[model samples]
Target: MKLDVELPNPQNLTEEFEWTFPVGTVNENGDAVITSTDKSPAKVKFKDVIGSQRVTLKTKLGGRTLQESVFNVQVAYNKEVKTVYFAAKGGNIMAVKVDKNKTPEMTIKPYDMGVKSGQHPFNIFFNDSSLYVLDCGRQFTYINDETTQNMGDGKISVISYDGKKVETMLTNVGGYAFYDPFYGYLNAAEKKLYFSDRVSGFAAISLDARNQTMSRSNFPYFVQSNRLGYYGKTMMYTSLNSAFEFVDGTWWWAKINSPTGVFRFTNADILSKEATAADPEPAAGVVFKNLVIKSFVVDVNAALVHVVENSSNALYSVPLDDTILKAIAKVDDIKTYKIADLPIKAEGTSAEPVSITQLILDKETGYVYFGLCSDDETLYKSGLYQYDPVTKTLTPIVEGMGVYGVAINNAKSKLF
Candidate 1:
């Protein structure tokens, strides 16, 4: 079923959009809300809405409930096996078997091999029978053949699913200490592990699956955010608000108000588009400058555009094809006019509804999901939201108490 959703004003997202929905027998409000519960099978309240069917799920079976936790959660799956995985609160990774007849749900278990407890399950990966988790700790933890009392050595834990054993890799990358929020990528084709800090520099650590040894190499560029992707033989890096591709062993980086930096690594010459090429500083600058960027996410397929909000409280995209950048390259800019806009306006909602949280996107289907909240403290107030861009629709896939995280393995017929 298609549900029309309005974009909060780009200038003011805090202001709620006055949109409503109606279904066969129920009336519902478009805004997000949270609920508190006292039972394991928690209770959720869908308050202030018109029609109930307007908030119903389109899937065949399975029910929704709130995820109770403070930290971010991640879900993984092996499409071939039709199984789903998730790291829930209290550092437990659970696997739920999916079949044609059962409801979409999960049961918890201890992997018993986490590199360290209390590590944020913010990042999860399933590559060839191994799970690579980025445990972003404020301080480093000790990880070696022995357990030590030194409680502060930031590290990445590599766990093998076969035996559920973990080993620490790469203590220091590029002379700086390690921190949480690591963007990890292992090239299945090349057998290489790439690492980068969401708030700072970039580097790579080569892993030998046989013995699990880490070798670090200093790669250039300061990445300001966490959203990045890899496809083909090329790895794309988003710096500040703009993005560049590392393909064919060459780095081609471009943006306005900053040097259009390019390097071949093999060659010593570092060329700046600003030094040799007179590039005009575009009005909608590439960088957010001094504004405090609150939240940002990239549409996996839309490489040139990203969704970001600055301290100015404005949501905008940094188009790689901005006129100024294209003018310097003496090529036609490829950016098309924006076809749609998000309906968020103002700031600081009355109890901090589910609408306040950032929407997580499914790369395969372009569906964005996020939970609703009634207030800052009661986080798991509502269930899951799936927004389809094609129909400009929003579907409340799951509903219950406030949920900590939302994960969908559509390929495996499961949601966690």
Candidate 2:
């Protein structure tokens, strides 16, 4: 005799299961009898079948098959994989799942931070669980025949990975007069956010303090008393356009304009008492002069700093050993420094020179990634490129989009 059976679709197999059978006639004793070949009509235990399983149920009477059915089961763990997040100019933050091949498997939807026109995401940094985004909000107009001023309303916001919550940590941070908040670094050890604000000078925000404030005092390298008597007398503050990196217990950064070169300051210097009008200047840290450093990345494990010179569109490497670092610290003024022979060139051609906007280093892989763009907006040459230090090869990864910022999630082994 034929019997009917039903099964679930792609059963989870993690929870309990129940099965119902059709009622049948009873014997003279007035008791219905039923039997299952594989424990049907009962709670199914999947302790032995975890990944994937094929189950079959059969009923037989007097060695004759009554009914048979088969079903498939899959067991999976409910968790989110690690992801890397990045953003481009006038674009929202996009996340990609970490993969072994170092290529994005898929692109997630744009993360909305509630920014309006004349405001966009400039940079992004990820901590253990949250993301820090710098939103540049400003409008520029010519003050007179020669000068222009920026009316500002910028902010720094922290967002959760799930895109469910957003918290504005700081607001009205200055950066629009020159460049936006182009680069930022998170010092987990010090619990501070160091970012490059061209207008207000390099600034830092204390993560541990209850009040969210950005101050130039946090950056001791810049001389706040230096005066510029052009148009009117104004204090000449340092303009930083690169991300800061911590190497060998010291913080290293580079400037975009005058006194342009790589510099470093000890943690003690950053944590020291703020400078006062009487003092005016903090203890000058080590300065490497005669180099126009637009952006740089430090590979602590390799003991080298890869630098990008904006003017020449060239790439150079500098040693980070104590011998060089000590020589710099001892000098009263900016000292001449030496750079190793060029390993890779960023210059494109005589007609159109490629401008390296940002640089990111992957210490684990010894690969340097850079974002390239040109002065002409009509040209579509702007894109992302990768340089393998070991092989000394520069290869284009993606094209069409002008990448302003790039970051890697080391813990997740993902690149953005």
Candidate 3:
């Protein structure tokens, strides 16, 4: 069998080709025969090869071989096991191949999927072969113009792992008035996406539909219909600060204002056709009277929930008991347990404490990663850190970039 290879030559320079074959398949001179036709396309001829085989072709330009352009031809068995995808605040989605020993190998970029810059991908959820991206659009300028007022007209989109296709599942959503979509959860079982909007409220969208618009009434709230106006009475919780999936498939969300505490709601409660005020209030517990929760993650294996206090950078965890996890209870029914305070100062300086913006737990590795950023004009302490709950030790991973979110592919032992 013969295979023709065309190496890209933007400069149109003359190139030499070297071909390598599987062991025991070479000619008597121990070299694979490669021929060039008219100093252009190179051809490799294979003789008496049986099962599967691999051939590699290398091109030399100016007597120097091009390392990156080496092409490999596989007879049959070519497969990829795992992939990791993550997004940044400035609307960049990156895909990487998991490499255990070293840093991940980045495979695709934003441009490859037709995603323009400045889209502000706040959070991402990955299933088997696709990534669910929450694009919060550009920050809202509040300029009273249509474009500015609708700056945060966000959407939930899904991009193929290979970056070959993109589909918008929902669009023209609210929630960019204050900040990016703060938290997002994908209920794969129910084919729904639940997200928190600082300005609008907590809402869920059915992934089964395309380009669906979510209104404030589509959320789960504790308020009444008289206050909701023409939207009608719906279960919409506007005070939600953050939310996480519980062990039993329900959801727990933290509130930002009065009755400040975490609340739990089930799929049944959200899907129920009830009035806004008549709708069951989120089963509340673990209340923090005056503290604002920035983010949280559920450690299912440990039966614990780690919460981050937005202002003080204080870490707290509460047990997943009936008081907090199963049924609704009063603030006094559950207690807030203090965990180790996150390290907010620079390595050797007594700088102002950096604020923690996000948190994620790798249940497999027992490592909790958080992102930090400072507001002081004179001090800028921003980076990613790993916290070991067992040792109560916090270690800095890398500094400078204000990492707002982190995700982990536990099956592949990869973090992003």
lDDT of 2 at 385: 60
The positional error of residue 403 in candidate 1, measured at the CA in angstroms, is 8.6
State candidate 3's TM-score.
0.57
lDDT of 1 by residue, 1-416 (tens): 22333333455423222222221112234334232121121222233211112222221112323232231122222223233333433434433333323234422111122233334333444556555555444432213312432333335555565325766654432223333324444455666655544333345455653333222333343332221121111112223212233433433322211222121121122223222223222223333222222233446375433322222222334444435332322111212322223333333322111122233445665655543333332323344344555664555444333322223344443222
Question: What is the overall TM-score of model 2 with all chains considered together?
Answer: 0.55
lDDT tens digits, residue span 202-245, model 3: 55777656655544544444322123221132213334355455
**Which candidate, 1 or 2, has the higher lDDT?**
2
Go through the candidates in order and give each one's C-alpha lDDT: 0.34, 0.48, 0.50
| Per-residue lDDT of 22 in model 2 | 26
Model 1: runs farther than 4 Å from truth? 1-90, 94-117, 139-152, 160-181, 198-200, 207-363, 368-387, 393-416
Q: Which stretches of model 3 miss by more than 4 angstroms?
A: 1-84, 95-120, 140-151, 173-182, 208-240, 244-249, 257-259, 267-286, 317-357, 374-381, 396-400, 413-416
Cα RMSDs of all predictions?
Answer: 17.0, 15.2, 10.1
How would the candidate models be sorted by TM-score, starting from the highest?
Answer: 3, 2, 1
